[model samples]
Target: MKTLNDLLQLGDPRLYEVCEPVQENELPMVKEWVADLHNVMEEIRAKYKFGRGIAAPQLGIMKRLIYLNLNTPSGSVPYIIINPVFENLSEELFELWDDCMSFPNLLVKVKRHQSLTIKYLDENWQPKVWKVEGAISELLQHEFDHLEGILCTMRAIDNQSFKWRPTPDSN
Candidate 1:
């Protein structure tokens, strides 16, 4: 089982390296990787109380993959996105306080497209496309950025657009 300690922190050179697309031959190997991602994501959620998704590069996988567990009215839906490509991005933008699994204790204000159309391979290596907006769109964008070697900190609205996560006492 993976732990939060398996995650690459900010300033880690591996996190800054662009990931390679997952090839068909490697489909058999993705299950274990996804499991590792899931394990670490759970650890992050239990410790920091916040974690929607995680990218493979964050764990030194060096592959274009992301694991997202989205909360819905019914329950959580987990998605394993492989080799994702942004098919479309809305012209309009929205700003939000975004946090990352790589830097769990920091929040960065950044602007992201209001909506996006993404094409990616599912866990079965089947093609899938999702037109998403709001929180889902934001989450996908954040994970996709990781595949491109971009971090939320690099997208900060300004130098002052960062703050530490507030503790229970501070709240």
Candidate 2:
């Protein structure tokens, strides 16, 4: 697997439109992509020391997939969600300041649910269901949005009032 650069900025047509589904036989390739994503995420985490997750589209793969690693006391355990579907979303909404690798340096305040239930296949193709809350919940929703061609910037609450900074050591 190779390192992947952050996705193209907003307004790029690639950032919009639904992504194609991954096929059964293509699972191997998806795994490879996931590996590459994990690698890039590790680098991002080490540098930024805050990023907890990344989606495949952030690396230019227009697929319904995401890789997340919530920080814990022990260490990071990577989680892979493929072709994920959301369920049991709370009506209660909350605002969060979000940043995306695809649209680096932009901090957009977006509204998201306080909790969410998601269903997706694991690395071994086993079905898994999980409910997330707080920051983890927000991270999942943000990456899920990437699958549907939505960027946090589009959902910014204050319109064009957000700020953009150059990603530290960004090449």
Best by TM-score: 1
Question: lDDT per residue, candidate 1, 1-171, as tens digits?
Answer: 567788999999998889999999999989999999999999988888998999999999999999998888999999999999996799999999999988888999999999999999999999999999999899999999999999999999999999999964675
lDDT of 2: 0.80
Q: Per-residue CA lDDT of candidate 2, range 23-123, in tens?
A: 66778887788888888877766665557788777777888888897768999788988889999998988987788766555788888999989999877
Point out where model 2 deviates above 4 Å. 4-6, 165-171
CA shift of 70, model 1, Å? 1.1
How well does candidate 1 score on lDDT at residue 124? Answer: 97
lDDT (0-100) at residue 100 of candidate 1?
A: 94
Q: What TM-score would each prediction reach against the true structure?
A: 0.97, 0.88
Q: Which stretches of candidate 1 lie over 4 Å from their true place?
A: none
Q: What lDDT does the true structure give each of the candidates?
A: 0.93, 0.80
lDDT of 2 at 82: 82
